[model samples]
Every structure is written in structure tokens, then in C-alpha cells.
Target: MVMSLALISSCQWKKKSSKAMRRRRGGAPEIHLDLLIEILTRLPGRSLMRFKCVSKLWFSLIRSRCFSNHYLTVASPPRPPRRLYMSLVDHLECNSMAVCYNPRESALLLFTSSSSSSNNATSFDQDLTLPGMGGRNMKLLRGLILYIVCRRACIYNPTTRQSVTLPAVKSNIFAQEDYRKSVLYFFGHDPVLDQYKVVCIIVVSSKKIKRITSEHWVFVLEPGGSWKRIELDQPHIPTRLGLCINGVIYYLASTCMSDDIIVSFDVRSEEFKMIQGPPLVSAFKPIDFIEYGGKPSVFDHTRLRRKGLVELWVLEDAGEWSRKSLVLQPCQMHLVNKYTKWKVKGTTHNGEIIFAPLLLCSPYYILLYDVQKNDLRKVRIRGIPKHWFRKPDTNLFFYFEFMDDSESIMHLEI
Candidate 1:
């Protein structure tokens, strides 16, 4: 009887142990989907993109509306922002004309003020081989690099590492009749309509001076269609073509011997209209025209007593122009032993006018003009060594673009 009782007790203990083992080996408790989403939403965009491969649960959590909205809201900061700085790798010149950014590191480092020169710069090192000229007339726009090589135009996205080769435009429109003159190429995009266009303006010899003849071609990338030529009723040649803003392409054209006119091309309507510019002397010619803060502006550099005097003109209204001259002190002008040539390249970003003074000098620098306060600040970057111009790294280049205010700082959802 005692032996039977012991066996029964032993069987009860065995049943309890078997129950505990089943609990440990069988299905684990399920994680609440909402809690899992909250954890994944904090990951950076680059990491989030990779996390999609983990499992279907994680992918769905990342792609959900609630998580995406929260991720974007928490990621980017509020804006009425000023300047944005982007860093290019050392190999920017050889491998590609543009440098690709790692999405995780692209968060905007905003500045409190336009003049604030804090640590607002960022760097990129990934190399991309774009199909075109190795390096000439390269401009960064809307995550795409626009470049030209041997009269062929190309638009490449460094992030995607995808390139689209534009077909050769008819040479007659840009080719010279005398075969001695050189053709000039200009390209820009219409962001509103999502269209990219290239303008080829050729200078041909007339009587004693050169004359301008231009052809405008538009490239629609939505459906990957052929180039469409736009007809201009008049024969006005453009000196420079600025990017399209608000559905209009602004061109700086010299209509007369003594004046430069601001011309606007309506991409949707395919029509041309002209805006009057400030009066100019017979010898004065327009050197550069760029869009600043959504308005057309012009820059002119000329010799005054064997010194360079740069003047900036901003369009106030349809026919009004405001002129601000940057008087480079005698000491500021460096002498070029070679051709005695000095050129000023200017562009606008984040409501400020930035100009680079290029000459054969010991110190090469860039000048920033604050349009709001009408102030000037000279910024010098200390990387290029002496004799650097002769053996230019060909690898060093600058990339500029407007930051997307909506998604500038959003965190990546995984």
C-alpha cells in the first residue's frame, strides 16, 4: 500500500514537470503590433530601409500610415529656414560629377540666421559614375546632376545611381555657320511641371560683332518621351537661361547693343514674354543672371581704372531693377600674371546671393551677399594648397540644392 502511494506521488510530480516543459517549448507570447511599430519608427531612414527585409510584420509596420506620419513629423524640424550646407567627398571629380548622399546622414543642419556660420555643413563620400563629360558645367538640381559632354546632355541621380542620356539636339540650332565660333550650352528644370529643358545658344559672327541664335528643347521624363522643340516667334538669343520657377523659364537676353532684357518663357503655354532691365552703357554687357529667392537677378563685372568692379542688380517688379555694387577694395583685387582675366560666378541659395571670385591668386575665396540686410561676408575655405589650380584635384567640386522643408528632418521608419 505504501509503495502504491509513493508511485502515485511520483506520477503527480512528473505531470507538473511535463506541463512546465510544454510552456517553455511551445508558442511564445505574441508581441503587440502597436508596440513593435513604435520601436521601429525611431530608426533612421537608411536602417529602416534595410529592416524591411527582416519580416513581413516589420515591413507592414514601416509602411503603415500612422507610423509614416509620426516618423516624418518627428524626423524633420519646423522651418522658415535659412542656409543648408552639403559636403562632397574627395573623389567627386574623377568618379562622378555629383556626389551621392547616404539618406541616413541627409538630415538638414539648419541655421538660426542667414549670417550664422555655425557647424551647418555635411559631407558625402559615395562615388557615382555619371555618363557624360568627366567634369564641366556641372550643376545640382532636385537630386539630379545636369552636365554636358561633346554637345550631349545628361541628367543623373546620384542617390539612385541612375542616369538618362539626352539625345543629341539638332546642331544647326547651336552650331556656327563659320565653324570658328564656339557654342554655349545652358540647362535647367521646371520643378512644378516636372520637366527638364536644355537651351543651346550659338554665337555667330555678324558684321563686326557676334550675334545670337538660340534653340530651346524640352525633355519630359514622365513617360520617357523624345525631346520636344519649342518654337519662338522671334529670333532673340538668350545670354543665359535660369531654372524654371512657378511654370516660367527666365532668360537673360541682350535685345539691343546697350541693354540686357529679362525674358520669360511659359513652359505650359510655350510662349515668350520680355521684362525690361536697367539701362546699361554701350560697353557694359551682362555677365551672369541667376534666380535669387524666386526672382530674377543679374550680375555684371567690368574694369574700373584697371580694377574689377562687380555690380548686382535685382528685379523688384516687372520693369524695375535695384542695383547694388560690390566695390572690391584695391587690396582685394589680386593680379593675374597670365591673361589678366578675373571672373565672378554667382548663384542664389536660401535667400542669399553667393559669389565666388576666381583669379590666379594665393587665396581663393567665396563672397556672400545678404539680400535681406544688404550685407557682405567673405568666407574662405582652407583646403586647396598653392599651385592647386595648375594641378586641380579635378576631384574637388561643390554641390548646391534647396532643402525639402517638408521632409528635411524626418526619422526613418523600419
Candidate 2:
């Protein structure tokens, strides 16, 4: 409906702007651009996207940073995004060695709540297979999702259903299998600069050759944006994707010396720094990255098996932390296997930590662990795509990535 109105307004505006341009021709536009922008900014995002094509003038107005910033702040903050998106991938039961779950098929699944305040099961909406060659490294910011396709990255505005691929960095490593094994990606937005950026880390393997090296690169989200390579002296294998908060991206990276070491990259400065990790850094142990009270944090999956206790380690300073332990209730304990391998999917904006079992030993359900109450509740998600649990080839298990993200109307320059 908003898009329809935006289209209607653009048609009307085009008629007016045409005469204004003809009247001024070589002079000032009869319709002041500032006045025109003010009126357009009030329209829905869907309308604005269509209006961009009305004329070069309208295109520049909608894509300008000044206009986007104004549009973002003009309205009351969007009701905290209840829309949830998840990317699920599980290996098939095919003969011989297994193949990658089709990156394009059943790659992304979305669900929307039936009401603003209801706690009942969520209703499934739609599924989207991101464009481009379809590579992993999926991250979302504001309302734009950053994903890699064909070894190159791209920004997608799901609100507008528009996408722009990032320019590929010139390199020979993309052809090497070793490079694929140690690649990590982080997508962040700098509120200070109102800019969206991508941080790519590639760790060179030593056992494959010798003397390993790690490289970093930054890609600004804009037209003609290219990867600008950065330098890093130490080598670390990234275990999970980076989490963005307050313009910084943090993730657990393992050095040969320690598994708790965290590597932080300032999205604006493009600099790398190290911070002390919480005590439980061990090899082969899965670390669930989360956000607690708006600070980056992590918890051990190992704690769950020990009487259903999970310790949340939140980073307060570069090398400091505030720890809190959440104990699962007996009723919650009965919901799933007491010793099942469970992983933290994410922390909700309302200060809740979400978890799901690695193996579907129990029925499909998500545990919402409340931080303040230390209680767990189940959010049963319905309408999951059929492909999600259908393991035609392998019935052993199905693994998926669960993400709790926000919805925004932020427009992309591309």
C-alpha cells in the first residue's frame, strides 16, 4: 500500500518537476529540491524506491546519505523488529562424501508474528534465495543483509527487494581450497558515519604449506565500492561469525597459543586489536556467541550437560568481563534431551538468550532463556520450509543456523 502511494506521488511529482525543470532550464528549479525532498521523505520506503527511477534528480535525492539519515530519524523508531530470519543448511544423505546443502535453495527462511503482543506460535511468511553466485557469510544490519556470492559480497535491502553486489578484490586465493577453510565475514554499520561496511578475514593455513598468514579487508557499501586490503601480523582461525554492536564487530578467534583470544575490528578505522577471552577457550568446543545488555558475549555449550547450567560471559572492557549463570528449569529440562548438544542462536533485544539443540532428538522447538528471570520458555515456529527437515539422503541429523535480527527501512546506495 505504501509502495502504491509512493508510486502515485512520484507520478504526480514527475509531472510537476518536468514543468519546473522546463521553466528553470538553465536556472534554479521552480520546485525547490529541498522542498521536494521533504515531501518525498515522508513517503513509505517502497514508494521511494520506485520514485528513484522517475528522474536522475529523484534518483540522487533518494540515495543521498543526507536524505536517508533524515528519513531514518524523522519517524519514531520502528517497533523493535519482531520479524525473524534464519539461514538453515544441513548435509544430505547422498552416497560417498556429502555435498554442500544447496546454498541457493532453502537458504533463507522468514517468519512474522500474528500480533504485536501475542506469545503464540509465529506464522511463516516467505523464503528468499539471495541473488548472485550464492556464497555463505550472511549478515544483516538495519534492514540490509550482506551476503557473499561467487567469492564476492553484496548488500540486499529485503524491504525493497533490491540488491547490489560488492566489487571483487583482485586475488588468487579464491581458487585455493585452503582459503575457503579459514574465511570469516562481519557486516557492520557505523552510526557516526551512517555508513555500512563489511570486514573479511582470511587466515592462511600453515600445515598446508608452512608459516601461516592472516589478511583482512574492508568494503564500504556504496557504488563502485571495492575491497581495500588491510594487514594483520598474527594468525587465528575464526570459529564463528562476528557480532556487531555500537559500530564494532567482535568474534572468537583461536591463536595457536589460546582459544579465548577475541579479535575486534573497528568498522570505521579498519584497525585490528586483541582482547582477553573468557576462561573457557578449548579446541573442538562450540562457543555460542551472544549479546547481553547490548555488549558482545559468549557462553559455553559444555555448561548445559552439567545439570543444565549455562554461564554467560559478557565483555565489559577490552580484557574484562561480567559473568552470569542461567539455570534451566526442570520443566524446560523435560522439553528436550538433558544431554543434547544445544547451541545459542542469539540474544533477543528484550534481553533473552535463544537456544536450539544440535540434534533433533526432540521435537523442533527453540528455548528462550530469560536473562533477568533465569527462566526458559519455548517459541514454537510453524511453517518451516519442507526442505528444512527432509533428509532424503542422511537421516542422522539436520543442522541449521538460527539468527534473531531486526527489520529496518534503511535504503542502500547500490
Among these predicted structures, which one has the highest lDDT? 2
Candidate number achieving the greatest TM-score relative to the actual structure: 2
CA lDDT of each candidate?
Answer: 0.47, 0.62
* Model 1 agreement with the true structure over 116-211: per-residue lDDT tens digits: 333322222112112122333554444345554434555554322345666665545434454224344455555455455555544444443455
**Once model 1 is optimally superposed onto the true structure by TM-score, how far is the C-alpha of residue 387 displaced, in angstroms?**
8.2
lDDT, candidate 2, at 333: 73
Regions of model 1 farther than 4 Å from truth: 1-134, 173-176, 179-192, 199-212, 255-259, 281-287, 301-311, 323-342, 360-363, 382-388, 392-414
Residue-level error in angstroms, candidate 1, position 46 = 5.2
How far off is residue 139 in model 1, in Å? 3.0
Error of model 1, residue 342, in angstroms? 5.5
Q: What pairs collide in candidate 2?
A: 93-393, 93-394
TM per prediction: 0.59, 0.78
Cα lDDT over the full model 1: 0.47
What is candidate 2's lDDT per residue for 153-237, written digit by digit as tens?
A: 6666665676676655565554554522455568887888877888877666656334445678888877667788887777777
